[model samples]
Target: MNRAVIVAAKRTPIGKVGGILKDFEPDMLASFVIESLLHETKVSKEEINDVILGNVVGPGGNIARLAALTAGLPYHVPGVTVDRQCGSGLEAVNLAARLVQAGAGDIYLAGGVESTSRAPWKVEKPTSLYREAPHIFTRARFSTEEIGDPEMGEAAENVAEKYNISKDKQDLYSLKSHQKAVKAMESGRYLEELVPVHLLTRTGEKMVIAEDECPRKNTTIEKLSKLKPVFRENGTVTAGNACPINDGAALVLIMSERKCRELGLVPKLCFIDSAAAGVDPNFLGIGPVPAVTKLLNRTGLSMIDIDLVEFNEAFASQVLASLQLLNIPEEKVNVSGGALALGHPYGASGAVLVTRLMIEMKQKKARYGLATLGIGGGLGLASLFERIEE
Candidate 1:
């Protein structure tokens, strides 16, 4: 297969649930990032062959197609929408690389977007089982098996319990995440990848949301310890340790080496390998362990060979568990902070993490970087990128 390389990657500043981007729709947010990418790279609209978008919640229209048109891309360009929960963004990138490697497309845009502020509140219709079995009022059998999807918070709590992770340990990890994120921000490490988004306020005032608004600047172990668990009464997964709802979008341009040379574009990172694994749905948060192992084995590289790692911080416990299971060094993981500090815009998280990883590797002059994430419904996805030196 021919090699595929990333020519450019960019992301809008992650906004908190009620922050500057709260009013923007997911498609609109995606369009903004895509437009910025085209302008920065000076790539013409007609050059793009395909646009792949990742979205977790919204109307079920063809978001990628709509986003492409919304961003002023040529109407002739085809688009596809993908959904792999939190891994959607990264999966889109992986798919785009495959297309280029197969010589199916010369240029592609892959990314994800989420607008939690506009997330639709799903209301399920009452099923026959629920209506007929009114007497079965227990929590375990309240609804039909097919209709009873547990919330992420409950799934995280289950993972914590199964792994025997303590609440104090999670709290401590969360505190470290915030501290590291604050340090990264204070040093302006994220400035390179984060595009400043000018948004309108509630009263039509313009404002720029440049910095991440989720990381608790004053977060401490003591402060986190006082918060109650949101999933279970005695659960370890608390609001302080879990990724918050967020709004953002991230995009990456992938093309074959020949195509980049033809366009006089510098290839930044070469795609190495990507893998996705499935596990028990109840332990969904720990899905990354097997996925990363498979990816490393396939590439004939050990965890130590990876110079940088961006494992989406879905929760402190899940992240800690995945690291311990993979025998990955903590120091090599999320050096610039993660979702806990930045924000986790579910559909856009995977691509966002990969973009951050690329920027971090470039800044540190690293050789290899790993971008991985645990997705909802017991799935894990990972991709390896090698810095392309001139």
Candidate 2:
């Protein structure tokens, strides 16, 4: 297998649903990122072997193709889209790494994009008796009735109950997430990976959005604890502890070592290993345990070797439980905060994590970094990256 290296990774500021980015299409947002990457890296679009994107709730078309064309890339560049729900973005990166390893391609552009605001209402099959517009939120995209899929929040509730995680602990974690995020935002630690973009308003107004839109400056544990449980009456998960629906896009330029040398491009991070795992749908939040453990075992490395970890904050309960199962110190995970504070743009968050992790690794001069996310329907995805230069 050929070694794959990441040349650059970047993401748009995650916008809350109905926020600054509500009007932008996911494909258009992705194209903007693609164009920014090409211009920043000076990499010719023709050199790209493929453009693979991870997307969900975008009207179910070829998002990659749309993004590529919108970015004005040559028509010959093959484009592919992968849908793994929340893990789609990182899955796309993993697929690109594997492609390089398998000698299938030398250079690839991969990432994820999502626009919850633009998600259309779906319709179910018509019936003689009655028919109404299907609720996309109610529909289980991952499994059918026989498979018994549960909503993400409901799964988080199951995790909290199964692991005996307390409401206090969940609220505490949620508070930490916001505090870290606010601190990072104030210090501008997130600036390195952010790509400023213009957002259009309903009344023909334009705003330049440059930072994540979900962090609350006045977040406190007390405030978090006071919020009522949203998933269930007695559930530990609350709106304050859960990731907000969001809009955003993220991408990375992946290339083989030889390709990097050929193009005179510096390798920022080396893709070392990745793994995906599954768990029961009810406890889907625990999916990261097997996925991350498998990756560490295969790499013969310990969580101790990882200087930073980006575990998606799908919910405070889910992340807290996964951290407990992995026995990793809280300080080592999401040091700059997570989805709880930044918002979850679903399909785009995985790649956003990778982009954030790599940037932090450089700033902290870390040796190894890991990015991982748990998906809907019992799936977990993880990837390990090493700093290749500086």
Candidate 3:
């Protein structure tokens, strides 16, 4: 049996939709982090067994292979792309670890990338032969019509209503997220894991995007309280309480424990285990509860045994509901804020959580860290990690 360990992780600064990263291609964004990881770990591309990446909305092609080639890896290094909606990135890492355990490969580069601004327009084929035009499809169907697939915002409303999470609570949680993110940014805590993207202006001037662009330093509960619901007229979920569309890429270098030791590479976090679960699509926000519960139970651990948690903040209501159901304190999760303030780049958010968790664990000198998130279509995924002692 082999253990998978992460030796290096890096991510591009998240950009708001139509923001600084809009002009960059998804493959290029992913390549930047891939190149950075290789440089930081001093690893050769020839040693990589595979490249895996998660992507949601982009041009219809294999982005992992495109990114690997863009990053200048050899032709022999094959790449594959995975799509599990918001859980895609976490699943990619999980697959990489499983491959290592299966003795299929020793080294793997795995993560995710998303560029909402550049996502191509999609259309569904006409249902009838007589129909001449295709209908625009904003998102892919996650469930059959019979099963009832609500928009993510509507699902958040369902979770809030079912779990008694109020509008005021959601607003307050979002405010705290912004506050914590502002504090972290001010202290330069995020710089350690960030890889700057250098861009050229139209005038040939150079520009460097090195910091996240979405955190509001002066966010207030008053402002959040004033915002109306986006999905329903009387719903609690609002733009203020939900994550913004964003663009970014994140990657981590994973290698077998034996190979990591052989290369004299220091392991940051040892991959312990991973779990996935599905729930009612209407209350999709509660997805993480069962997922995390199964993970802890299978590993013979509890919330008390975990030191830190990174629950993707797709919506404040969902986050609060899931935390309450799991009996996990809010203080133990997202110590430096989450997608509510940092922005969520869809497919890349899960990997971003892992990247942040590794850094937080090292700084806090914690032992166990968990990365978990509720995915689109009522799915939940979780991965557990243990920090390596220096």
lDDT (Cα atoms) of all candidates against the true structure: 0.86, 0.89, 0.94
lDDT of 2 by residue, 82-193 (tens): 9998999999999999999899999899999999999877766656445564434545466666866778888899999999989999888888898999999999898878
Measured by TM-score, the strongest candidate is 3
**On a 0 to 1 TM-score scale, where does candidate 1 land against the true structure?**
0.93
Which structure among the candidates has the greatest lDDT?
Answer: 3
Flag clash pairs in model 1: none
True-structure RMSD, every candidate:
3.6, 1.7, 1.1
Question: lDDT tens string, model 3, 1-390?
Answer: 799999988899999999999999999999999999999888989999999999999886999999999999999999999998999998999999999988999999999999999999997767786567777888888877888889989989999999999999999999999999999999999999999999999999999999999999878999999999999899899999999999999998999999998999999999999999999988887888899999999999999999999999999999999999899999999999999999999889889999999999999999999999998888999999999998
Candidate 2 is scored at a TM of: 0.96
Rate residue 133 of model 3 by lDDT: 78
Please, what is the TM-score per model? Answer: 0.93, 0.96, 0.98
lDDT of 1 by residue, 1-390 (tens): 878999888898888887768888888888988888888888888989899989887666878998898888888998998988889999999999999988898899999999888876664445675565334321222123574446777878877887788899889888888889999888988887877888777698888878888877899888899999888988888889988889999999888989888888898899999999988776778889889999999999998899999999989988888888888888998887889888899889999988988898888899999999987778899999999996
- Ordered by lDDT, highest first, the candidates read 3, 2, 1
Candidates sorted by TM-score, best first:
3, 2, 1
